[model samples]
Target: MRFGIGFVGFACLAASGAFAKGSIDIGRAVYVERTREGVRELEPATSLKAGDKVVLVVEWRAQSPDRRFTVQSAVPRDLAFQRAGSDAIEVSTDGGRNWGELGTLRIGSRLASAEDVTHLRLRVVGRQRGRMTFSAVVR
Candidate 1:
């Protein structure tokens, strides 16, 4: 299955328009682009493979920005969660129902690894292979 980055067409993350007087806006883009000093451009992803590393860049802008924000994204079952360097992440193992830190997560009595995470809550996010949607609110 394939997912679109700019709208609600795909089961992955849906990108919606700016909200509430347009003071704050959120945008989503998935790319296969790696962070390299020599790499000038990031390629957008049209499809995903088994072990592809995707960079999910969520853009947030506001006339007056808040000190903090809580961003949530819905993860597709096909993609496994990967670790980003941010410290403000809470992950869910049981769909989007419950969320916990990496150490606190479990699946049927086994502790969750960085690889077993399903959903990611953070300032920025990454994944293995699946559809995803991102949402954020200024705090």
Candidate 2:
């Protein structure tokens, strides 16, 4: 379940042109879920072990008026999603075909859990330029 050397390559980070008049840079880092003081942090990930938390960083810089756009990143098959930096994030468990909140999405008769998330879509509602992260675990 570890994120091997392959995970450090471009295949592990997905970037698309969903942003309008803007560009995004995506990268992966090891997620330090908590420390002795309960503070979270992110470290460069060279190799990751099973169950290790990984953070997908999506940073954008835009020069357009009303920087409204959507960005989507595909969750690498080697990882299971845990959470998103924004509370209003949407998830897609079936590739990128369908999207909804975890509580409303279903794989069958059961509700989808965070771990079932396959793709993450974030809507930058306004002219905000910053970084957004999604946490996942090495499967």
Candidate 3:
């Protein structure tokens, strides 16, 4: 009985450690305004470790006539871009001073739509230790 209990405890600890090591926490920090046409606001702020692959997911309503949006990344100087999309997004390694196109999200024929989600992925590279900001503009 003692052996069985110890084995189960060891297994539980190992499982938790594995989960913690592989976990990436993504959070949203923004005030979203809703309209009859759609919703609008900046993308949520995210905190990620250096050299971590961060996938940003933005969810909003597309009820407005504006079918266009812009996503921007304000990255620290030390990080390098692995990949990004253009038309819908731009990435800046210099903290929003200059930006290059990254990615795009297509709404297709859907306009004045609501309750839609858009996703973007960025690989986070560690340069210096600090916080960075990212945003999305829908006009």
**Most lDDT-accurate candidate:** 2
Per-residue error at 46 for model 1, in Å?
Answer: 2.7
Question: Per-residue lDDT for 2-109 in model 3, tens only?
Answer: 111121121111111212443322232322223445754433223333333332232222223232223223322222334333333444333344444432222444
lDDT of 2 at 128: 47
The model with the greater TM-score, 1 or 3, is 1
Score each candidate by Cα lDDT.
Answer: 0.53, 0.69, 0.28
Candidate 3 regions exceeding 4 Å error are 1-52, 67-69, 76-81, 85-88, 101-139
Better of 1 and 3 by lDDT: 1
Ranking by TM-score: 2, 1, 3
Relative to the true structure, candidate 1 reaches a TM of: 0.60
Better of 2 and 3 by lDDT: 2
Instruction: For each candidate, give its TM-score against the true structure.
Output: 0.60, 0.77, 0.27
Best by the TM-score measure: 2
TM accuracy, model 2: 0.77
Sorted on lDDT, best first, the list reads: 2, 1, 3
Weakest lDDT window of 10 consecutive positions for candidate 2: 18-27
